[model samples]
Target: MEKEIKVSIACMTYNHESYIAETIESFLMQETDFNYEILIHDDASTDRTQEIIRQYEQKYPDIIKPIYQVENQFSQNIIVEYINHRRAKGKYIAFCEGDDYWTHPEKLQKQVEYMEAHPETSMCIHAAKRVEAKTKRKIADIRPFKESKVMTVEEVIEGGGDFFATNSMIYSREKLAIWPEFYFNGVVGDYPMVIFGALQGEFYYMDEDMSSYRVNSEGSWTQREFSTIAKKKKHYAEVARTLDEIDEYTDYRYSQAIQNAKKGHQFYLLLIQGKFKEIRQEEFLDLYNKMGIRYKLTSRMKHYFPGISRLLIGIKLNLIR
Candidate 1:
């Protein structure tokens, strides 16, 4: 009889030749009691990423399944999540891109144990470390809490797209199979996935840091999508619009929270576009009040010293990503 697979790891790659081997190695190192499969989808990479994946597939045919695309489907607007997910044979689906890896050998085992015990959770996420992609330097730890707790839909919306690390998520396949309308419509995947999962059932968060998230890596979404001011504006606009749709979908049950979340995105939009005066509007006071003293000083100086404030604002915007 075939071994029962408990987890299916979904990895999508483009030009991740330098990092794909490490990603696959991390998955292979998982010390799980149950069987698991690695499903890697290479979107017709021009580099050696596909070659590396094929090597691993040949070495571990039973555990590593791959889809080698003839042409780039992502550019054609095909969702990678759905493609790999359709072939998944596990109870839970874990996400890790080719550019990222898990730090803990027992990451999957620990998460699977917790998920099995808590049938109420539709998704589970843990803490992760953010590393500078080029230097591979440790930047910071993305710990959502000091202790384990359940995350609510409201909190998930407020946290935005970068709320939790993408590599740290393991969600129920059943929950994801029934994708919400908003999930299909959103420009980004991670934020919508968490929102849909939270709506389906509670999201249990473990406080352990077991994954490494490479920020602004080449071919990563951040690098490709937000490289220009126009792209940044468009991305934020789509996010806020998606949040509005979710509000209506939920019959305005979470309208207040959703509106606040949209405003937060708008705040960054205004800040980045150098509309410092508009940021002082009454509607944005809640976000403006929470700004640091130095930022507040800069905002004030924009009135007297427009040139210096504009230069400072440019520097600040670069760090936003």
Candidate 2:
């Protein structure tokens, strides 16, 4: 006479009016026997997103609970609040955003069963089908590791280990509850959460592609253009700050700090080379010092020599552009 475990699906949305209905329909079609709830958090958007969500909430009153925000709180804040407040009753938590929809109806059932059977794992993640939203094309398939693997903090910090897409992760409530202050400030929040999960225990990886991850230019983070020198420098500074904060307490503290510092230095170089716009020499030099690049020759050598150090430092800049 034990109570059945419940799962809560945290579906966050912004202005995804075109895809919101499809996303909600997918969750409504889940073929799980156990009790499940879909908690939708909608940031204050000036689109028809609220209307669509209200429609679903009215139709599926028992299963769907919608939290429509009056003011705009970015994804980082919304996710933090959703995780803290909405996950009260569920023993397990899963995530899918408004743009992404679940492809497999049995995804919840399969993942919940796997986690229930395997107590050693803190979370279970599966493969996802990457779809380009504009063309509705299948760009690629993101697959997870073959078997259950224990990930170290260093591997996660260096971004070397296999990672599951945020939409595909199903984690235990007990594991998530430990980190109450888990809010991300940078462009990458999922990475830190995955690292935290890995540090807690082994992660189960299912090779099946059960979810779809839609990539489009309409979303909040993706829509902003960081092409200007000021914008790029500000972006890198925020990234460096977030990484520094993570490193301050984590085991791979020093290495992550060095990595962030190197990144800041490269961005500084780009700003100076007129690839972006001309920044103040003093300000640029101050950032270089903060990033631990004191010698002017060292900075010049990186630009002129074209070695591995230059390659590693300039990789992200090239990729973003």
Candidate 3:
């Protein structure tokens, strides 16, 4: 009889011909004594992505299971649908995209052990190093929280500091089953998942850096700018709807959700105008006030000034880059 797998790695791939192999190799190199299975869902790719997946499937039949789609799903709906339909046997369900690869072989082992030891903890996440694809240079390091504790809804509303990259999180099967459909529908899926996980049980933070997140110009949602005002408005409405759904919870977290929604509203306005200069002092002040942030008009003026705002935003972007 075969031993049961302890972890199910849900990997989604689109047109990642260049990086899929590295991603798969990282999973293969995991130095764990226990059994684990990798479930790969390939959204129909026009490139050589399918070929690479096929090669790996042949080489690692026992550990790798590939779900190849003939017609493009285009959206994450099919990917999430596949994960739900297939039914993972493992106690823990971990996620990683084909474009992102793990840097540490003990990544899964360490997370599994932590969750196993802490019954109250529903999820575990570690830090990730962001690297530029072309230069292969280390751009920024996203470090995890040093202390492990139950995250409060208030903290989440305040935009809980550093969240584990979606690829870095390992969640229990019991908690995953309760994940709402809204998570997959949002422009950002990871945030809702984090919120759901925290609601279920306490979160375990591993300060160590164990994953590499590659940022490139191609095949990224951030790269595509919403050119039309209608598109921008639609995006913002979706964000608002998502936040409103979470607003019913009467906790500090609800404040954080409102603040996040306010920020999203401000950003959408900026994008719709096609220039950040279009944002007036009054507009930002109104936004801050609506978000419940206490600030004077003078401070708002300083923040809206082109030169000052540019310098501050430039520094922040540089830090991320």
TM-score of 1: 0.90
User: What's model 3's lDDT at 35?
Assistant: 94
**For residues 2-65, could you state the per-residue lDDT of candidate 2 as single tens digits?**
3454898888787899888989988888998898888888888689999999998888887888
Task: Estimate, for each residue in 206-295, the C-alpha lDDT of model 3 and write its tens digit.
Answer: 887889887772554444434456666776677666666666543444655577655756654664444434444554655434532333
User: Cα deviation in Å at residue 243, candidate 2?
Assistant: 2.7
lDDT of 1 by residue, 1-321 (tens): 899999999999999988999999999999988999999999999999999999999999999999999999878878888898899999999999999999999999999999899987899999999997866677788887889999878988888877799999999998767777887788898988888888888898899999999987878878888888799889988988888889888888888878878888888878866787888899898788899998777756875688997897679757764
lDDT for residue 25 in candidate 1, whole number 0-100: 99
Clashing pairs in 1: none
Segments of candidate 3 deviating more than 4 angstroms:
76-86, 144-150, 160-163, 224-236, 249-253, 264-321
A best-first ranking of the candidates according to their lDDT comes to 1, 3, 2
Candidate number with greatest TM-score: 1
Residue 303's lDDT within candidate 3 is 48
TM-score of each: 0.90, 0.71, 0.77
Whose lDDT is greatest here?
A: 1
Candidate with better TM-score, 1 vs 3: 1
**All models, RMSD in angstroms:** 3.9, 8.9, 5.7
